[model samples]
Target: MELTSTKQRRAAALAIGAASVLLALFVDEPYVLLVAVAVICICIGWEAGLVAVASAGLLSSVILFSLESGAIGGAVRLAVFVVAALALWFVIKIFRTMSFYDRVYQGAGPNIADIPGLGWSAYPDGRLRFVNPAALEYVGVTADEMRRIMDGDDYHWTQFVHPDDVEASMARWHHNLETGEPVIDEQRVRRFDGTYRWFRDTAVASRDEHGRITGWYGQMEDIDDQKKAETALRERERELRLLVDTVPTMIWLMTPAGLPYYFNKRFLDWAGIDAVKEEPRGTRQFASHVELFHPDDRAAVKAVFEKSFARGEPLQHKGRLCRKDGKYRWIDSRFEPLRDEDGTILRWYGVNFDIDDEVRAQESLRLADERLARALRAASLSELSVSIAHELNQPLQAVVANAGAFQRWLTADPPNFNHASRVAQKIIRNADAAAQVVARIRALFSKTEGAPHAIDLNVVIREVCDLLGDTLTSSGVKLDLHLDPRLPATTADQVQMEQVVLNLVRNGIEAMQNVSINVRSLRIVSRHQNDGTVEVEVRDRGRGFSNPERIFEAFYTTKPDGMGMGLAICRSIIEAHYGRLWAENVETGGASITFSIPIRAADSIHTITAATADSRMGAFRD
Candidate 1:
């Protein structure tokens, strides 16, 4: 809508006059009043372009009072300038077909205060700048407080650093001087209110064209949380030592490779020391412990260790560590490799227990087993001797009978060569039978080399059942298998599984020792669950679990001779397979021991991977 004549121009003048009244009354800036008059004149350009000067003169009548005498207040001045620019714009847009109000009102100004997560710092030359606002907030201060801190003439940066770390900072500063390298240290820095907290600071040498050092550009960040955790760990170590000392056993902590980390007070006593002091440390942790092992057992110990240490054998057995005493003592020890979140071995922590009595018992049992085997062999040989005697008697008797036949044949002058050949063949067969018996006895006693491969839980169960097929039948225990058909194979040596399953089923048989002949049952079941895992549940009926949770704890058991390690071993196996194992009472009767293994997918299941940028199905750009 354009103004077509002087009448319209007069109408625009009235509007400016009204705005001027408002500027003098509610508003403070006279410039806004002048801007309104100028806008009226500009709009009337087609009719009063020559008389625009008079309108400009008329714009001077608005301002009466102000925050600034002869000048506008900061707030009023800013608004006035803004309004004037908008009024000029409004006049220009009136010539266009569309309204300018829509565009002008839609756009909003940027917020300088909320620039976001930005910190500010200034050089020594009084440039007020934003340092790490994060560090500022962490130190519990505001930007204004920071300004006061930098300007404070009394306090230096190191004055805020913790006293304990001050020496380290000084050392770093000296090193930076010599090497011309950046000085970085984690220490405490002072706050504006004179409190100290953890701060990580770095000072890098700034160089010019000539390569001379200008000034250092420094950065300080708070690391109080990390420092607090470190302090907690230090305290924890002391507490752990105190706890180990309280235990009666010769408790020694070791690395996976039999290296000594440290020993408790009990271990120190066993080693003939009063109390192990800090630097002499009684034993430098790790590799050093290996040097203290009994000379004769070292090779055997290291070989057994290599099986699990070098190549991770699912932690299976715990054995002895001979102490400071020359006499060999059985110490139940286990190694658990300390791996990182990515499964890389960072270190290991293990414990050793005094199991000298248990070792003696095992040795005694082994000797007894050998003696029993010998006695069985003797009995079997005695039975064989009786058979041999019978065979010899029959031959001697047959020879006597055949002597007359031979004489008859000789008299007839036709030799019975076919009969002689048949006798020779029979003698050869009898000799071979004796040799086979001897071989069977030798095989039963001889040491066997290991045959190992990846094991499937389903296959393992079947094999165990098959191996004990006759034993189960004789014991009157029926084994019912409900195995999952599609269990993914595990990277395990089948021999280990053989040992574990054999032990478990044998334990099951022993568990059911109290079951009457009318109700003997052992069930081995396996299935792939909804969580994409394969599970094996071994259930038996006899006496129910006392405490299923406690059963798997090392050195916990009901049986007198039961090497409390069976359930513990099962748990270790399950965990090594990156699985879980636990025991729970069945509703009907008895207890069920269950183990589950993750079904390894075709690829790793991380949100991102090395090839993720090229992923066929994703929004990640390369």
Candidate 2:
């Protein structure tokens, strides 16, 4: 075959065109220069040639028209330029046709067979026409052996396919031949050594100018390593799936955006939700899961989930999750991020466990505490009933006496208006006093539901001391009060707070009953602490507690007749109000029980209306 040099032709044509441009510029004989330009353009090639010829024609006309020539000379020059351009166009047409055929011939050379992978071609009848050395090597066969196999009466190239893949391969081949479409498939082919390896084959239908199929040419790439890797990965995935299903706890897997995609069997059974079946339409898996939560808890769960998803943080939420039977059960759900080596979250892994029993247990304990508090209050009120009645009785008798005296004065023979007015004033005063006494008694024993409210600890101490005044007098115990009027207000249940103060004062009085009158001292003090708290202390100059700490424990006390719930209830109340109640032995030979309640933040404290309490009383009359 003779070789054609495109580079040599290109250089020669470029030089000729340059010379023609110069000649057209300097020579007055524009027609001769135009002919030379046309020749150079035609030799250059197709589309490029047409552009060169047109440019040359324009340049030649520009030079000729600029010459000092008559009309005949210009017309002749124009005619010559037109004829040369026409001649270049015809030559370009032929050159284009020849170039197309040359490309086709070059594309058919043996270089394609030397491609990295296996290469082969087939006739329209699906018979192997050629197989490259690479293809034969992959099949572990020589050229002669491959030919011998192809010559058999019923044999085809598919005979070299693994037995398991031969049927499908043959079917696909036949389909390709009938439809004149491409054949692209992956299958295992048997080598001469009887070992099968995977290969990916792709063949496109070779067509002629009429677009009719003539043959098929394709390549086969060894994909044995890739197939083995995929198989191993699938096996590992199966093992992981089996392990997930068999585990006891409910588990789920979600995308990094918190959309659940996988759920273990236990999770499905727990909520009666299967991710594949119960998935919401055109929405994320979380949409379906959000419904599983108790309606009141869904918003909280979503808020936490979104925050955690955004921050890549772990989330723990406890809420009621709906069961298949329409009942809701408490579940403790926790989500942890599955992170890569760079600490980037790839997905979210979560587990949920039933915690209904634990929640029920906590609720039961709370109810029990409430009942115990009520019982303790009732017991304390029983012990103070006599003193409380005396406190009210004296005021009531005075009102009765004063009213009687006022009536007598009004009925005087010569009515003394001034005397009657004085008597009436006394009657009103006594009645008001009686009402106050009753109010105090009722407030101390009030049993309304307990709720926290801001109150002055100083006032609570004074009221408790006044209510226990008669008891103190009868027991020969001298009561002392050291209250700080400047103490900050703290939040707590008023009734419960009073109960705590009263319990401590009563205990102090009882502790001093065996001492001498002068020595029996029960001192109650209220003061402000530096740490934003109001402290109340009840100190008794009596037998100190052997173990102060143990006294606050439930059902533990020193008194024989004691129900042992007073101090315990007091401690519970103080703690519930976010306060500290503790006891210590005073060095001088008494026990001091001090409780400090934290003052509420200014913004959190509200001025809610409650029964007014009197902080001062003159004396307790026998």
All candidates: CA RMSD in angstroms? 28.4, 21.8
* Full-model lDDT, candidate 2: 0.72
TM-score of each: 0.31, 0.53
Residue-wise lDDT of candidate 2 within 1-622, one digit each (tens)? 3222434555575677677667757776566565555555455444566676677677677777888468788878677777867675676667655543332222244576576677777666776666777777877876656654544433367777888888888888889888987889999988768888899999998888998878778888899999999999999999999999999989988898889877888888777775566555324667667988899999998888899999999999899999888999999989999899999998888999999989999999999977887777565555445445544554466567667777888888887778879867766755666575566456434522223567787787876666556567779888788889787777765665776787788888888877777889888888888888888999999989888868876556688776565676567656656678999998989889999878885445332112211111001100
Q: What is the number of residue pairs that collide in model 1?
A: 14
> Highest TM-score: which candidate?
2
lDDT of 1 by residue, 247-292 (tens): 7776554454445566677777776644435345334644445445
Model 1: CA > 4 A from native? 1-181, 186-196, 244-246, 250-265, 272-303, 307-311, 314-322, 332-350, 357-622
Worst ten in a row by lDDT for model 2: 613-622
Cα RMSD of predicted structure 1: 28.4
What's the residue-level lDDT of 597 in candidate 2? 77
